[model samples]
Target: MSTEHNDLTAANREAWDSKAKEYDAKPWQKKIASQVAEALNSHADWLGADWASASDQECHLLDYACGTGSVTRALSTHITHATGIDISSAMLSQYTSLLSSTHPSLVLKTSVADLCSPDPQPSISGPEFHNFDIAGVALGFHHFANPATCIANLASRLKKDGVLFIVDWLPNKIAPGEHIGHAHAHPDSHDHNHNHNHVKEEETEEWKKMKKTIKTNGFTEEDMRKIFEEAGFEEFGFVVLGEKFVLEMNGKKVEKTGFIAKGRKV
Candidate 1:
């Protein structure tokens, strides 16, 4: 790996380790749990709509960089089991604690290894990696050091006819703090009593640091399409799942216009 690439990966691990607690503690982050849950359901829906009904119940999922495992919790019912992998143990720890409480009987596994490793190259098959029917990368593309390798790894892990899902913020051309807005409507029971700008300064600082090291502002449509194609996936489909998330960080209301993208392995 290039020095810059290694630096970015290390920086992401450190940044996430430092901010894992605060990141998960944010009121918005907590609220996102259900929205992500809903998104997972939508992924299930999409699979049924685009593919067949028989494959629904037996599918296994891989939650790549599954920070806090909110999606894994939501996905408990739709698939046979799910495995979450991340580079930060702190993030996985938070995920485990929440997983045990929210879905006590969930069959979940976690690892603190880079799925996008380049040297030995992380394995994507066998008892260790498992054959994932659906693999989702939620809001994680920007943190990748080499997206081609990352997507390739993800694509390689899928069972035949399996799909890869990518959900993330739309790319932008400006600095932070411009897209401020009120939080979206979520269920009242999951709501919290917190201000939008509560962690503005800290997140903004993190954003600045991300601007320096993160791979991209976010992935564009063409960017993602090319990525999927380069990874040897076919029949790419993109779904606009609405703005399911928004957080005021560093005084900027970062609105999340998520996409439920899928690439089938033919």
Candidate 2:
């Protein structure tokens, strides 16, 4: 990876690690998580036919950039096993804790690894990580330094005809001086007790630091389609969720529309 990309990976790892403990503590975070999960479940067709009809033991999911296993939790009932990979160890710890506590019987595991790295570790590139029936990243695309490379890496892990999907924000126009933070931005950091015309001046420093970890505001349908095709995937499909998510960031309420895009490995 380039030095710039490595720096971004480190920054994001630190950002997510710092927030892992209380990631979904806010009501809005929980609500968004639940809604995204439901949307994924409701549109199983985008996940491919094998995912729709396969027996539990026959399907395996690779939850890439899987912060606390939101995608895994969403599709656990349908797949026999889920392997999660993320750069943040703390986030993986949260995933482990949640899986053990709520889904004890489910076969879900996580590792601190970054497949986006040009030279992935043996443990991450091994057979164990390959041939997944489906690979998905929920709300993570915008944080990636290179979305096309990320998609190619994830695509390499799937078997022929396997599916790869991403659930993230669709491109939205931001009005003048309006700031729309990433979906996972912490609500607690914002002072909600007071009304303000702009984001708090004190929060600007922190936001600046956090913004380093975000690579883009959002992706368009055409962008997703081109990347998926470049990654050697076919049967592409994209769906915008029916519900919009309202995220409170440093006292600013930013409404976002989320979309899911998928393609089959060929």
Candidate 3:
């Protein structure tokens, strides 16, 4: 990876780490995360979306950049074992706590590892590495500084015929504007005492910026497919969630959703 990409990965890691604490406390975020998980779990059957169930087989699964395991919990219901990875320690901590409290029987495991980096490929070294039947990244792929290299690294860790699920924001959608100027920009930061109106405005602006930035970061249906294909994924196809996510785009109402592309490791 280039130095530029390395630096970007560092920044993303920092951003996620800072926001981890407050992210866990937000009730709305909890709802959204759970919803994402539920959607994936349900939609899998329709798209033949089993990462590990090739030939009706069961296998271990990994959730890359799994923030607090929102999707992990959803995936856990279907798969026997699921593990989530994030660069933020705090976020993983909260995920573990949540699993222990809400779903004790679920075998939810987490670790602090930057998926964008080459030196410390967490999934490959973790106890679960050899066990993973499929690896997934939800709404987290574009954050990589060098997406191509990251995709290549992730692909190397999977078993033959093992699948990879790449889920993220799709283009041609409405979204909220960026609110970093008014609301809490850091992850560990909180703004409970802030006025409701101010929060709304900030979130509105933030939503817009997010969409723009995601576009700038080289995110799109075509880009995702190319990256996965280049990294040795085959039989890839796109799947989008029907739910409309509310956000602001240039001060306009926007409903942003995601698409999941699944492929087999050739």
> Candidate 2 local accuracy as lDDT?
0.79
Winning model by TM-score: 2
Locate the minimum summed-lDDT window of 10 residues in model 3: 181-190
Candidates by lDDT, descending order:
2, 1, 3
Q: How well does candidate 3 match the true structure, expressed as C-alpha RMSD?
A: 7.1
What TM value does model 1 have? 0.78
- How accurate locally is residue 170 in candidate 2, as Cα lDDT from 0 to 100? 65
Pairs with steric clashes in candidate 2: none
Per-residue lDDT over 1-266 for candidate 2, one digit per residue giving the tens place of the 0 to 100 score: 79878888989998899989888888889999998889988888556647534433478889988888888889877777788899999998999899879888667767777877767666675688789889999988888877888899898889898999999876566433233454333332223354456464456655666767876677778888999999999999998888887776655566778899999999
List ranges where model 3 is wrong by over 4 Å. 24-28, 46-58, 120-127, 172-218, 248-254
Please give, for residues 9-37, the per-residue lDDT of candidate 1 as tens digits. Answer: 88888878877777667787777767777
| Per-residue lDDT of 82 in model 3 | 68
| Per-candidate TM-score against the hidden true structure | 0.78, 0.87, 0.73
The lDDT values for all models are 0.68, 0.79, 0.62
Supply candidate 3's per-residue lDDT for 20.
70
- Candidate 3 TM-score, C-alpha based: 0.73
